[model samples]
Target: MGEGGKRKSRQEEVPAPPSHRILTADELGLLKVSEVPAGDKWEETAAKQRWGLPDKAQGITRLQVHCPDWDPDRCLVAAARSSGRVTLHAGSDGGDVGSFRAAPPASTSGRSDTSTNAVQALRFSQPEGSTQLLISAATLGGHVSVHRCPVEAALATAAAGRAVHTWEEAARLQTISDLQAMDVSSSGRYLAVGGDGHQLKVWDLEVAGKAAMASTTSSAGPDGAAAAAPKAGEPLFAGKAGKPSRSGLQDLAHVTALAFVPGQDDKQVLVGTAKHKLWLYDMRAGRKPQAELVWGEGRITTLQPVADGSRIWVGNGRGHVEALDLRQAPAKLSMGHALKGVAGSIRALALHPSEPLIASVSLDRHLRVHHSTKRSSLAKLYLKQALTGVAWLPPLPAAAAAEGAKEDEEEQARAEAEEVDAAEEEEQQDAGRVARGKGKHSGRDQQAGGGSRGQHGKKKDSKRRKQ
Candidate 1:
């Protein structure tokens, strides 16, 4: 036993771990970097303080922002704290729209099971052709709950009365343990979830949404015995089921990251494991993974598939972010666009739904926003707090993006205005001075020569008469 009553490891006797210097934006050759302002001014730029973790509990664990590409306005950004506190921020500027606690599902396991330490996974989904968004939060205790949030209705309620309720419980999902990660599809048809021991399970959210709708109409069972209300944390698969992909490897590593492949009608997904490898699966085929690609090192944290499906961007620990093309026979990887000069492991990566930007938060407390198209560093900001995760706030309408662009352009124009054209100014002054000089000379010549002109004319007449 060492100093604290525990066995000391040999590595602990050695020197401390080497620390890598965090690079500046200029040193990293980055552009358009925005740093959090000193004091309370930071509240104007980022919402860290506005949605911060309470001073009492552990820090924030996860964050998810709603990005509605269409004209949707209700659900904006939400933050989940370590003490099971969830706050929803809505509107253009992310404000506290709603806050709720994920109380342990009653009768789940037993009455004694009351609460979980923190929210393990948080996801926000908007079903197709639906006015409300479904929010799913899973706890470490394997209890998951889904809630329906109505943005406009909440605002209307606030206007009518003092108290405004933005969201309500939609459905509760059965408890699943060690849920490492989860993702919802773009079409909002399916949900891909994975974690320790449990493999990938894709739930048909459309079916779940329909069930939620049906439950509203029939409050009682046909026998009139008063139907058992759907448990707040009921297993979604128990009623509306989803297909699971087969990965033949029984000795599977913990699933640390998950992404639904695009342009496949939601039939394919890419799963990243803790073994520093990637396994691609096709839901339409057998359970075994279709392809496996090995990265050099580091635990995979996030995956982003390109629109064309030709390349996939993978971010991992040790600050390694690179693109991989699985089409080639050997799964050719690209070193051209890798994010360099990044220290610390990436905790989360979020890509803008409509814009060419990808946001990444790492252990270094830096939130890096990169250009997705060029794969270059656009901006990097340090929010002071140790960031655990990040996600893009749901996109506003085209007009809002356009307005933001307009504001940027106006600022650029103002900056350009400050750089006056010195050459042009000098040229204009010289021209004015020349014009004034000519005017003065002309006036003097006209007055002095006007009287002499008569005398000269008389002399000319006398000379002509003499001749």
Candidate 2:
């Protein structure tokens, strides 16, 4: 019935709905805080190509450096250089203060070979209320070594006593399966090892209440079918076989990095793969991953779970560093932009436990510090060589947290005050409106009644007189 085959409405025409889009910039007080610029040579600091090096100098083609938990004092720092020797450096004032050298791990044939081998990973275990120890592992021919913290410190204390006390080798070059990455638990109770063609293996260093390891041999079932059981009560700490954690037969795809989520009851463990996936397992539960995080096109080379288990930080071979909020669903997660120019895979990342900072090392021979929360560059150091490891100093006395009860009480009081003020203001306005409305209605009613009464009196008087 309409002009162009359009149906006519039976009711009156209605106006179109109003647009609901707001296109104005919010007037937030955005203060551009002054930033500490990277050093003028900062660009060069990240450069790997260096000239003018003596041939005999062995210009650090590959190096693995470890920074202890973000403490200001008594932090352990060590590096394995290209000269087939591991160096221990005392990190003080945010720089190297002293240095010492230890002989490389013995070869498989029980021969000490000082040939050039890359240290694949370095980890430090300083459990709460326990002494600190440094653990470093070299690749090319699996060599794992552990040294007490004081041995090097004692030598550094007495430089005149040139007799450099050698580190007590814990595990030698007996291959742990050509692993690319290793992680030591902060509690010093477990060590997670992973590498090429192997499932993640966690070694219990304190098994049976002593410093011991499981035997490195094939296990047998009752039927002698070569069951993959850890040897007896305390199996060998060699091989890819171990008592599987909650994530059974982890069977990773070329593990690239491993880390632990500390300060949690579950003590969740994270293993990253060269296939660009990360598996999160709850060690307290079973042998399967509780969750998985996948990112980027390249292998995820590093994973650093923050002090709390709710957030995770990962670096991949494609030069991407992303922050993941585990509380969100996989589809609704938060992420930061990729740190550009970061190349050759991020071999290591360390978060400052007390500060909003992160330290990262790459196979590209650069050490960069980023603000973890803002995802901004803070500082960078160029070692002119590939970096295999990194860590932040342990927490300092200045890192003490605010008193919980005091902070909670203050927040509660402020919230209560705001609520009370809002409620009182609402009550006052409501009472004023109610009073005005009552007075106006009452006056109108009185006027109406008076006019009716006057009319009625006039009519009654006139009718009576006429009667």
Candidate 3:
């Protein structure tokens, strides 16, 4: 700074602070980024940017996607939260489309318990060649309710002051004491329920509907009074509890998850238990399980069968997700390739509709996508909260896809223009540096020329003095 007798800048004179400062625990916690490791920072940022902020209340408990036949262009995704709320999101962009309360209204005379009101299971069904969508929701208190709404009108928004089309309660029933798993048959005619009581019960919805209709009809009794109505919650088939000598207990193991095999006309159901066992039951056969498979990992948590009914995916409590070949004999059913890289228990697993891809959510706060055939990780997103459920949204419509492609092309063009502008600016800077270097050399040459002239003048003066 003192080489040319110029004053030093204040910034240069003062020393800079250290690059990094130590933070306290409270400070780090307040930032909320402390839990994210350096290697996962990019994934965390990407997930947040795509899905927005994590929910402030309880996390999501279940996810279901429905694509109606009447309107093939629009798809809806239902998310059941632990806070006893069910919300619908647009499958295309994951935007909140609508929401409706799943739990019944609380009683005026008694306090309501939130834990008992939480939804334990959810399923969507549509009858063949029908325009209505049936949504079944099961609560922890063993109450199951089915609601119906027109599939085409489900996604339409209402005017500012008008009422919107909403789901109407079709039927309600009471099942086991602590309902844990439920599945509706593909035809929307049968429902299966199981819980902590180790009892599996199947209900014929067609029969229940007929009974409800008959009860509504006015009938004369023997004493000129109306006849009594029959119970609508009675199950058509109920499995008996296992003997004490079988498991050293009076009851069989509790069911934790349930899935019906696809392409089988819903005749076969897969039941998973807390005892690390898988049970295959045929509806035509007796209540006994036709086959059983013991898993090596922790208890089974979720089950999903592929479309062709060739294989089934099982997620366990030990963070292992494996596929089992269903074509093999029940006694010889062996585990297929297992998806890796999960550190926590998988809470849910979903297969893509058309692609050979599978998605899973785990207690590790991650949503991972894996290839079904290669069993390799395709993508991983680090959500801030522990993920409980994940489902694939339907593909975008053709018109929407084309519009998105056009927008992407515009964005690409804009980025290329910006790059070209930056390159030109850099080239100008290089030219300016060359010009400045030439000016400096010219100044030095002029000074040297003046020195040479002065030397010549001194020599001439010496010669004149000698003369």
Candidate 2, residues 1-467, lDDT tens digits: the string is: 77544535522233221111000000121101011212222233222111122333332322333433332244434554445455444333223333333324335556554553555666555556754454544443444445555533522421233333446544432335566777667776666677888657666655521322334333334665422212323222333322344867544447777777765542556777777776666665556566665577898777777776677788888778887676653234455645544556776676665667677777665667776666668555555444555554332232121232244358779999999999999999999999999999999999999999999999999999999
The Cα local distance difference test for each model comes to 0.59, 0.52, 0.67
TM-score of 1: 0.60
As for TM-score, the candidate ahead, 1 or 2, is: 1
If ranked by TM-score, best first, what sequence of candidates would result?
3, 1, 2
Candidate 3: segments with Cα more than 4 A from true spot: 1-45, 48-58, 68-73, 94-97, 155-164, 209-232, 241-251, 329-331, 395-467
Task: Give residue 344's error in model 1 in angstroms.
Answer: 0.7
Q: Model 3: per-residue lDDT, tens digit, 251-347? A: 3659988888887777788888888777787777777777777786587888888888889999988999999788964556778788978658878
Candidate 2's C-alpha lDDT? Answer: 0.52
Better of 1 and 3 by lDDT: 3
Q: Name the candidate, 1 or 3, with the larger TM-score value.
A: 3
Residue 423 CA error for candidate 2 (Å)?
83
Candidates in descending lDDT order? 3, 1, 2
RMSD of each: 24.1, 28.8, 17.2
Tens digit per residue, CA lDDT, model 1, 271-356:
78887777777777656676776685888888877766666778888787777675551244343367755667887776666666
